[model samples]
Target chain A: MDYLEKEILVLGCGNILFGDDGFGSEVIQYLQKNYNVPSNVYVDDAGLSVRTILFNIVLSEKKPRKIIIVDAVDLGKPAGSTFHLDVDEMPEIKCDDFSMHQVPTSNLLKELKNFCKVDVKIIASQVQYIPEEVSLGLSNVMRDSIPSACEMILKEMSPL
Target chain B: MGKRIIIQPVSRIEGHAKVTIQLDDLGNVADTRVNVVELRGFEKFCIGRPVEELPRIVTSICGVCPWSHHLASAKANDAVFGVTIPPAGKKLRDLCNSIAYTEEHILHFFFLSGPDFVMGPDADYSVRNVIGIAQANPEIGKKVVRNRHLGTQMLDIISGKSIHPVTAVPGGFSKPLTQKERDKVLPMAEEVLEFAKFSIAFAKENIFPKYLDTVKVLGVFNSGFMGTVSEDGALNVYDGKLRLMKPDGSFTDFAYDSYTDFIAERVEEWSYLKFPYAKSWGEGFSMDVDNPKGIYRTNSLARINVADKMATPLAQKEFEEFRAKFGRPAQLTLLYHWARLIELLYNAEHAVELLNDPEITSRETRVPVTPRAARGVGCVEAPRGTLIHDYETDDKGLITNLNLIVGTTHNNAPINMSVNQAAKLLIKDGKYDQGILNRVEMAIRAYDPCLSCATHNLDGRLPVRIDIVDSEGILINTIQN
Candidate 1:
């Protein structure tokens, strides 16, 4: 894999301040610490307002060939499994359950897709304890899957 | 030449809404309407869900005030569960509520609503938003952003996220606070406390004076006050009885959980919004001050009035002065913004105190309990007003039914009233100017209604259709009046 072709943008969306739903952010934090990727690869906290991040994508003039969003998707899956999905095919993400400050990155992706030609993907970890009384940390299963999920994402950005 | 207009989908405020204004016979605003449109089916959808799911389910009602919904839902769940949460749970919930208020008010004032006031009312539509705010006063703008960041940061440290918080549970919190997290949260809260203080002082000194004449001359000031009063007569947010005070100083109180007994909702033909009135008081007159019967308002100012006095010294002092100056708890709707800032101070201060408390960090974030067939009512002070969640559940902890009497629902009538008043006030003397009508729109935006959450349906665009009408209610030359 050529270094120049290894361009990857790993963006973690959603507010980490809100309990188990912050799994994506927690995963991003882990990836930031452990992942060894080419210089073209970049990671962003993105936070809860994923919509705001879209502007950077469209207006960057130098558009990236691909974008990956890491978030806690409520797929009713077991706590730890990783689901890689094409942004357009994922279930209609419900932005209501979270905070008002947030517009779903998926929604933002849909909006951006209209104006640009970026290959957008979502890497969502399932959340079982959202809306329940819980801490901000991911569940045990979600936490355990971080390294492997990060590795898979790195692999997807392969052929550099 | 035809005038240009742009209606941004899902107007960037609370809940969901869209704006539409018509051009005059001479390319000016002949009429304007800010549509409070969102068809949320929370009440209908909530029907038949297990009562225990009320807290979690209703928390999705609005991203802005999930904490309020969570509390109201939890309290309703508790009522249905036929068990009262312990004192610590109640206080912790109140603390969470306060944090929610602090975060929301700051978002509304500084980020959402503040832009118009800060960057001239007629600033370019695109730039008059957050980006515009960033360009105009970078220092204050950065401070506003940082203040919100600090508040959300603390919320994340405590509950998980500032929005869609996860700290709340049906029985209680999922986990208790650790000293380290509490310690981390405190200093950040202190910064927010400082910012909140600075905001109050800034309001008193800078912002308040600028809007003083505007408040006195232009804003809606005659609505009655409503809020939750503690058993001991305090401005209790988490667990308390509901109260609706009349403009003439009369009041009614019901068990917080028994919302159905005291309040009845009347839906208007023109709007999907429901206007709640005190069932005891009977119906409301159409914007008539003489026989004001509807449950008028909730949240910051009303909460200040319902409680004996504010717990914090600054808030108490401000509350006293506000009441003294306006006479009987400033009924003016615009003052809610100021009152919200004042409460932000109180909320931040309260959060600081909670964070500093050594016991807050204790590892008992949960209260073990089992669900039973019962009804519960949880009420909390959302940034807009008092939000009540009533739920009935089965023994298995599934929600059987749910009802969210949101703060915006109560203020629905007053919102239309204010809009009508502003339209009339601005359109007087045959003025069809866009700037004049924008002032009227700004007045309505000040309330920050969360109608989308009230209805349970989250999608709708408010295509504002403002038409000029004659004195006899006939359609006069229709324009964006």
Candidate 2:
């Protein structure tokens, strides 16, 4: 069996151009540099158009047992905090006013859920710079939470 | 000597612009100038990012046609990685492109450009918007609103967001469609098809003829025409070789890979925008030419002229009749709204066909591969016109450079010329009265330019200032979105 055939895929999505909204891309870049994962594990930077991410979901030969997405989300938490949630836990995240891209993510997810069966996980980092100009470096708070984000995702993917 | 009149901040347009009309001392029109105030920097920002990330990064530049950016950027990345996706991915990408164009056309005609036609040009600006449409004919107006909303919803369902879709990645879509999702869109697609058919008849019989008699025609000279041309010669909006047809009826088709060779942009001192013209047409101003060859019009007019046939039946019939009436390759600039409507009808019908295809719901969503760093270029026909994105990546696949040629950029010269022509024509006899400003604005809005989409710097910031001075002389309520 191929390495990518075994482990699930994790997609990091956001607009790196829009200040903190780029948190997902930033984290993905970090993971690409640091993490040494199982052979089947695939991670991608999806950017602002999550709809296009659907193609990536389709191309995986072995259906990812699970999929994880890391992004900077505004769940009304303190500016530099991080939160993790799965498909079941998604409802708890208030979706009253989504960033314009959120509408597309919701729409893509709706369409994708019907065709594939993969556990969906989101690790969102809240930040002050939603669209404000920011640097590539992660905030201290989000930086600290990276380890936990990685740990939780790994645990979820691990076989008991 | 020529007199100049400046119309600053032309009213009822999406972006900022200033128009200058150059009139001979005898009050005859001499020349025209239009200055678009916005400046974009997409190339500078493309530097230092992975080529694969270009599609996802550039998608945020516009809220209207992110799908175009997504496809173009993805194509660019595909070039760098040297990956060719399956035919299904290409078809799905085309479907997404078609949806984007329809949604944008609906918004432009029904919401933005609809008022100028449905309501008289002389109608008060305040009452010439969607609200005005609702107030005038409640039922007809509701249909327009519903169509636009339904189109947006359909786009939202498929592409993730209606305006700027991110789901169109390089190689293929992020996932495949399901029977349930396909079912949700089937009925809506049918409704849109019905609405478009009704709208086309409405436009041809009732709307267009009414406006034709008094409609202000701008630009006496027929200039260069350019658009994406597929190998099959259908109006290739998703991706294709670009074709440029000169006023002399001679045409040249360049593979989008050879884009840099055929297209050359000239920078003017008066405006921040650059004028893109065909390279074979010669560089700089030509004196032997009676008409200004440097100024060329793009978008719908160019797309219609460059393609041999349209994919949809209704649009093809309309294209023939339109050419017969207005000459082969119609140049009546305001008639773009009509052409856009025709294309919308085609796109809606096509979207339905793609949605019904069982293969579109296939389980094989993505094929994994290794990333090889290289240069890539992607081009698609956007709602406005052909949009091209080019990227150069480092060994690790990070983008080192980027170049994006949006539809609006291609029309900078013609837009200026159109505004100038309208001002000169309407303002004849030296009286600042009656429909001059409206006519000028209508000319610019014809292209449906989205300036925000041109903003390229992913991390760039602008100094936005909002001033409210209190009695004590202190600035209050400083905020940003």
Return the DockQ of model 2: 0.05
Docking class of 2: incorrect
Model 2 spans with C-alpha error above 4 angstroms:
A1-160, B1-5, B22-31, B39-41, B214-216, B283-290, B455-481
Tell me the lDDT of model 2 at B253.
86
lDDT of 1 at B19: 42
Worst 10 residues of 1 chain B by lDDT: B456-465
**Tens digit per residue, CA lDDT, model 2, B153-193:** 67657666553456766677775667787799789888888
Which structure among the candidates has the greatest lDDT?
2
Estimate, for each residue in B1-481, the C-alpha lDDT of model 1 and write its tens digit.
2232323223344555444444444554444434454444445655555565556545544545667777777666666655655555655676777776776777677656676677666665545555556557667665665665566566666676544555677677765666787777778888888888888787678676777766765547566678877777666665567777876767778877666776778866656666777666666445443335564777676777666666777777877787787766567767777878878877887788776666676565556668677666667777777787666667777666666677887776676566555655665434455466556657666777665464332232222234544334455543321
The per-model DockQ list reads 0.08, 0.05
Candidate 2 CA-lDDT value = 0.64
TM-score for candidate 2: 0.71
RMSD of each: 8.7, 11.3
Q: Assess every candidate by TM-score.
A: 0.74, 0.71
